[model samples]
Target: MNQPGEDFYCDEALSGRTPVTVVAETADVLAFEHTRPFWPVHVVVVPKRHVPSLTDLGEADEALLGRVLAVVRQVAADVEREHGACRVLTNLGRYQDSKHLHFHVCSGAPRHPDTD
Candidate 1:
């Protein structure tokens, strides 16, 4: 279970409130290890500049979205290379605990087998 703080990805990871193990990053995007990984291999990707959610994207967000997707593609490729399969996901609405726009790249077994 990834016990993310009350802060969203922006306030936690981007603003440096929470230290993160960075996987990849560009001036406008970042991919880092999940704070508390649910899966054996879990990583989080987000735009350095805050975008609220997927539905909130605009034409001005295209460039940043491209950069974020590029990073997600690379990370997913790496995960699938080792695990044989990987899942990329983005949650919206009530499912989204954090309001920040982000992607999840994950694979393998659960980190904590005890949890459902």
Candidate 2:
């Protein structure tokens, strides 16, 4: 179960409290399979360091964000190649569940009705 206010990527995934199947990794970024997937094929890419949200970036975060996106691009490309189609997205403000900057690379129909 997830808490109401928590940075799942930083507190669980990046901290290694929750083991994840990594798809790609870098010094500043990590991409892995979603623990609880909302789609048939779902991958999550995030900065290893906590950055509250996309709009919360600072000047120093630009490079890290680029690295994160590079990983997202690779993961999305792989998913698209394997599944024929893919979607890359990120939630912000009220739409974000976890308070961490992350992007979803997914393919195929959503597995859950509540997927956003």
Candidate 3:
């Protein structure tokens, strides 16, 4: 059964929405676009399992956690190549909305003077 914040990443899924780039995926994760991105190359890294919070992770989740980071690195590298450069970040406590453990990979700023 899904937990309270497990559906944090589900907003886009449930809404049947799509983002600009869905770079990669694994057995336990999905990488997609950030709806309200803070950077030029913004992507969201989500786990396939509906895990409600990073603080709530258990023994079984340890491996999944590691895999998430691994994917983040790979994706970040790709983002740099494709978009030049980017940032990888994760929110905690009040910073997180979905309560689900996710990573935000971004490249460049929301408004770069060079772009404008």
Model 3 shows how many backbone clashes?
2
As for model 2, its CA RMSD to the true structure in angstroms is 3.7
**lDDT (CA) per prediction:** 0.84, 0.86, 0.74
Residue 60, candidate 3: alpha-carbon lDDT: 42
- Indicate the TM-score of model 2: 0.89
Please state the error at residue 108 of candidate 3 in Å.
1.1
Q: Per-residue lDDT for 1-116 in model 2, tens only?
A: 33544788878999899999999998988999999998889899998887888998743367788888888888988888899999999999889999889999988877866555
Tens-place lDDT digits, model 3, residues 1-116:
55654465765543355443567888877888876666767889877766656777633468888888888988999988988878888777777777677888888868665665
| C-alpha RMSD of candidate 1 | 4.3
| Cα error of candidate 3 at position 83, Å | 3.2
Error of 2 at 107 (Å): 0.6
Ranking by lDDT: 2, 1, 3
Descending-TM-score candidate ranking: 2, 1, 3
Total backbone collisions for each predicted model: 0, 0, 2
